[model samples]
Structures are given as structure tokens and as C-alpha cells.
Target chain A: MTPEPSPSAPTAAPPVPSTRPAATLQRRLFLVGSLLVAGLALSVVAFGDLGEDLVYFWDPSQMAAAGEDAVGATIRLGGVVKAGTVQWQPDANSLKFIVTDGKVEVPVEATGAPPQMFREGIGVVVEGTLTKSGVFTSDRLMVKHSNEYKAPEGEMSAEERKTLYTTVEEL
Target chain B: MNEVAEPVATGVITGGWSYIWAAYGVTWAALLLFLGRALLLSRAPDPEPE
Candidate 1:
């Protein structure tokens, strides 16, 4: 007969019930589910914050209709720059202009030089608050160019062209 | 950027379609990658029994 097994001999360790393959799969599924739920929660919060920051683009006519209720709220105003309404005061570092969308006009006051692409008859978007005084106080102005790269119609007037060239020379 | 006393002359801003295209392309690509990963995981072979 085989020699009696020694009483103190070491035996293979028993397999852990909790460490089975099924248990591992369950743990993995729980982790993935938790991650998905966390991601969805994060996405919802981000979208909610974005909703507050999304300024709606409104034309002058729309703004006019909004009346006093629109005051003090930030908005993106889009319209064509009204010709012969631009007044630039270099001394005061202020530029005032009127934006019109044919149906209505809004006066805009800004504290810096207009964008290089800014000119009469061009479309623009101004970001600012509409004051109770019915003036749009713009802090940021962007020129809206068409997707088609076509030459602008008409040439600048002699006086305006001279002023532009002189300004360029100074720079 | 310095605040110029008078408006300066400059060329028209152009050629930004590439950026727009890239933005949309990257978004779709990421979505596709995520979908592919999910499908692959779902089809993965079950672990062998102990």
C-alpha cells in the first residue's frame, strides 16, 4: 500500500467561491453599467449649462418686438450695417452705428475700433446687452461673410478710401 | 490685440470650411468607434467554465 500520507503534508488550496468566472463577469457588467450611468449624468449637466449660455440670434425686428422684456439680457443681434449711420469718435474711443434689417433699426454703441471687415451694407453679428435706453451696448462684434467668395460690389468713396489708407499708413 | 484709433484695412476672412468639415468628421468618427466597441463587446465569447 502507498505510504500513508503524512499528517502534516500540504494540499492544494481550495478554489475561492467568490472568484469564479461568473462572479468576475457580474462585476464587469456592474462596472460598465455604473460608468454608463455616470456618463449620462455628466452629459445631462453639461447640456443644461450649455442651454444657459446659448444666446439666440435675433434680428432688429424681433428685438423691437421683445420691448422692455429684452433689456439687460445678452443677445446676438444680426443685421446689415445701415449706411451713413456710422459715427466714429477717435477722441472718445467710441464707435456708434445703426443696424437695420429693413423692418426695424437698432442703435449700437461700441468702445473699440470696428472689425477690419466691418463696412456699410455688410452683415454683422453683435454680442452684447440691450440696455433699457433701447441701445445695444456691444462688447464683441463679428463681420458675417458669405460662403461664396465673390468680389464686393462697388468701390469705396474717395474720402473713405483716403481715410482707410491713412489709417493703414499710421499702423 | 491693440485697439486701433481708426478702422484698419484687411483682407476678407475665408477658407474655414476645412475646420467645419473636421469638426463634423471627428464627431461621426468617435460615434462610430463607440458603436463598434459596443457591438464587439456584446459578441465576445463567454468565459470557459472553471
Candidate 2:
């Protein structure tokens, strides 16, 4: 037989179920969704600026073909340095050279000590703007080295170097 | 345009490796911090029963 309840005892109500789990899950989902949206927005803005600033690499022939459209825009030009066309002024710290990709040649003027490996007949990438006059004013120059590492051949003839600074400067 | 535009000479960018390194460092630090925070939260103790 069950014991009888005391007259003085107070009745206790049933405990309410907790909603903490659902609230915690909702908070997590909100945080994750917000982060995703924010990241997407940030990348869109970053890429937009990058697309404008990042210049395209082009060879001498391609740059020539680009014509007036190539002027005033920053571009990275890649070509082999034409032999016998390098003019360096030590006092002025100015260097001039003609970059040729066989078919076409472009004159480049840069102000800085050439890198250790810089020389004639080597591939190089010059980063700068092409003026309306057609001279590439390079601020940064990078020499490209081949894996084979063969020594440079003899000097090119004066006839081969005939198409030099004069031709490109006229552009 | 009839008039030829003058080229804007940009200065040579030298010694820029420091900035590149700093950017990489900050990115890694942020990633690590986020991972640590997530792990800490996942291991946090549940609330005591009322």
C-alpha cells in the first residue's frame, strides 16, 4: 500500500523541456551562412581590382598587332634581347635595349642596374607601360633562364642589329 | 585622341618580399585562430541541468 501524502507538503509541477539545442543549432547555421556570404563579397571585390591591375604578357609581334590599343596600358612584354643593341650609360644609370621575338622588335628603356644574369640573346620579361611613341618604359625587368643553360653564341652582325631603337622609337 | 599621351613612369618595386611574407603570415595566423576557436567551442562543456 502507498503512503498517504502529508497535508503540509506542497505540489511540484513537471519540468519544462529545454529549447537550448535548437537555439544553439540556429546560431551556428546563421554564423556559417553569414561567413559564406561575406567571403563571396570580398573575393568579388578583390578579383575586380586584380583584373584591372594585372597586365597581360605579350610578345613583340603581339604587341605590335595590338597597335594603338596597347598604348598607355601596363603590360608585360617577353622577348629575347637583341644582340649588339644594348646601350648602357653608367653615369646616368639608364639602359636601353631592343627586345625581339624574331618577327618583331620593341625598344625598351629602363633605369636600374641590370640583374646579374641579364645579357644579350636571353629571354626577359619587362613590366611597364608602352608609350604612344612605342617605347616600352620598364620599371621592372626579369630575366628568364632556360633549363639547358647553354652559353650565348657569338655577337650578331651590324646588319642584323640595323633594325634597332630608331625603328621602335618612331612608333 | 590627336595628342600623344605621355607615359606614366612607375618606380621599380624592390624588396617586396617582406610584404609578401607578411601577407602569408597574417593569412596563416587567421586560419589557425579560426580553427582553434572552432575546436575550443566544440569541446566546451554543456550547461548544467537546472
Candidate 3:
């Protein structure tokens, strides 16, 4: 019968080998470990010393409530300069003012000349340590100006005119 | 006009480019290391069954 079957019919082709690489347990562990280490390194670099280096900004009222904890610690006190409390001593090169939050007032003795914009009733930020005698001894002072701008509504007072025209030494 | 001109910023920020380059260097180093690791892992042969 002509050797029966012709042996030409092909059986099911062998399954094609997968081409994509499979992730091994070791590789997965390495990936996880690399990510964990990177995250830890970034976190340590960013947040280390955050607490110790942070300088707290407090108003007079908040500072007063802090009591002894605030004493001798470097802090930034922000408040409006109390009117009639500004005393500039040109000979002494010292500026003494009282910062008030409308409820509490803190006396500040700052070394060096004040900024041109610094005046009574203006917002200011003083940075330094609080003395045990309840006075803030500041080495740096900054004037804070409001974002709102409007044209002058009235004539300038003599005092204001003098400040605008006079130099620090003349003041 | 006698009006005072609007105040303009006269100061220039100096020496910040080094920090930017340093940040890019770190990022690129990490990326290249990761890429090398991935390529090496992909080309490695799987162990034959014992």
C-alpha cells in the first residue's frame, strides 16, 4: 500500500520560546533595595537639621506666651513698631523700639542703623535672642512693606518730610 | 515729566549655575547607573534547572 502514511503531515509546531526577559527574584530585590536606599538618602539630606536650624517667627503675643522657652533662642519677632516708642541714638549707633501686636509689646534693642523705611507704625521683623530682662537684642532688622500701593492722600507731615529728605547721619 | 519713574530691580543674582549643574550631575549619574543595571539584568542568562 505504498508504505502506508506518507509521513508528510506535520504535527503541532513546538511552542515559540518567549523572547521577553523575565524579571528574576534577585533583580526585583535589587530594584526594591535601590529605590529604598535612594529614598532614604534623599530624605536624610533634605530634612536633617530641620528642627535645629528652623527659626520661629512669632508675634509679641505668641512670644510672651512662650515665656522662658523663648529666652536666649534666636527668633524672628514680627510686629508693627509701636508709635512713640522709637528712639534712635546717632552717637550710640543704636535703635530702640517697641514692637506691638496691639495686645502685647516687646522691647527691642537693635545694634546698627535702621533701614530708611523703618519708622514707627510700620511692620518690622527683628532677628536675635531675647534677653533675660525681657528685652529682644537684635543684630538684624528688616522692614516689611505691604503689597498694597496707593497714592498719597494728604500732605506729608513735617516729620515724614524730614525723614524723606534727611540722611541717616543727619537724623 | 517730573514724576518719579517706577523703581526697577538693579541687582543680579550671582553664582547659582553651579548648584544647577550639580543637581543635573547627580540626576544623570543615578539614571545611568539604573540603566546599566537594567541592561545587565536583561542580558543575563537564567540558570538552568539543576
Per-residue lDDT of candidate 1, residues A49-88 (tens digit): 8754564689898889989878998888999988767777
Best by lDDT: 1
What TM-score does chain B get in every candidate?
0.62, 0.62, 0.66
TM-score of each: 0.47, 0.45, 0.46
User: Candidate 1 docking category?
Assistant: incorrect
Q: What is the lDDT of residue A161 in candidate 2?
A: 56
Q: What share of the true interface contacts does candidate 1 keep?
A: 0.18
Candidate 2 docking class:
incorrect
| Stretches of model 1 off by over 4 angstroms after superposition | A1-55, A151-171, B1-50
DockQ score of each predicted structure, in the order shown: 0.10, 0.07, 0.04
Sorted into a CAPRI-style docking class, model 3 comes out as incorrect
Per-residue alpha-carbon lDDT of candidate 2 for residues A24-82, written as tens digits (9 for 90 to 100): 78989999999999999999888768764565679999899989988998889999988
Q: Which residue pairs collide, candidate 3? A: none
Please list the C-alpha lDDT of all candidates, in the order they appear.
Answer: 0.81, 0.79, 0.79
